[model samples]
Target chain A: GESVGLHLPTLSVQEGDNSIINCAYSNSASDYFIWYKQESGKGPQFIIDIRSNMDKRQGQRVTVLLNKTVKHLSLQIAATQPGDSAVYFCAETRMSGGGADGLTFGKGTHLIIQP
Target chain B: DAMVIQNPRYQVTQFGKPVTLSCSQTLNHNVMYWYQQKSSQAPKLLFHYYDKDFNNEADTPDNFQSRRPNTSFCFLDIRSPGLGDAAMYLCATSRGGLAGPRGFFGPGTRLTVL
Candidate 1:
């Protein structure tokens, strides 16, 4: 994925409501997918990851769902809070008989929490 | 306890001048990567080092280069900075052979070109 600057899509949800951020990946052979959250002025922090063989994986208060048929991935926050407001990015990579190579990231979504 | 450390959280350089951003890791992972991220955009992979071997992305500009002296440190050098080169530079490390779900990232260095 290329970096197309500015005007990121925004998702606004009331506090305590569940927030779902969606991403459409480019490659069908990508066997690994991960979600990252970036706060203002900070680098992306890894949230959760799932492999192609699994359709869903859950972490503390967060869940990742992958649909390989449509090449779509979604991150769901169980109970949203102001602290959860950040830019969410979904990254994909394929281990094609090589080392764990660089990740290709999708255009991020800016998650905004409402009061 | 920061696993990945990036020096000079902010950098300012003049157009056409050289600038270097540094990253160091304590985890001793064999794979380290550099990514360039502009505001409101996703990070684009610049290059990576596995142990001492360097691999650069095909589309990464010739002006951008990276060096890894050892397993612990990596440097990104921009020989001639353009206004478009200004962005947040992120460093990451992962255990080389796996899917790298545990890749740890640094706090990033934001570059400003005048």
Candidate 2:
């Protein structure tokens, strides 16, 4: 992934309603993508992941959709709650950047769950 | 339960002093990563160790370093802490390099430079 500036976009949703966070990745060859949720004063927690071979993967109330054709990814959360308010980041790993290195993260999207 | 643990949940160090943050995992994963995140910023990869092999990010400053003595332990060493270096240090581990489940992250060590 190409280096990006520090600014990030934000999405606000009402509590008990569904929320959708979107991301646009730079690398088309990225084969693996993961979504992470980082709450206040905590490390980024893994939410879900999707491989390039597949278009969508679901886990619990979270679903990751990958659109390789547009080099885009989105995470949909069901029944957003106050606990879901946090910074969400999407990371991508490609076979090209070297061998099995760590992921390259996006600028992140702040998910605000409003009551 | 399988989880990642980080020691010294809070650290305070004087400018130019050396500081180390520790991380350990019970999942027995082979890969470990260290990241630095400022307030409201994305976690930036500083470096990682695949077993004993150390891989550093190209843009990572010379002031930062890391060590993974074994499969479950990894450490981040700041040779000379600066005010700008003060941030939350996160440690993560994964079962495999790629095509693996979401990597597990430690609770993070919040570092404050005096």
lDDT (Cα atoms) of all candidates against the true structure: 0.87, 0.85
- Report how closely model 2 matches the true complex, as a DockQ value: 0.55
| Residue-level lDDT for A83 in candidate 2 | 91
Model 2: lDDT equals: 0.85
Model 2 per-residue lDDT tens digits across residues A30-87: 7888899888898888898888899999999899998888788889999998999998
Give the Å error, residue B12, model 1.
0.7
Considering summed lDDT, which 10 consecutive residues are worst modelled in model 2 chain A?
Answer: A1-10
- Listed in order, each prediction's TM-score against the native is 0.94, 0.92
Q: Model 2 off-target regions past 4 Å?
A: A1-8, A95-99, B97-101
- The pairs that clash in candidate 1 are none
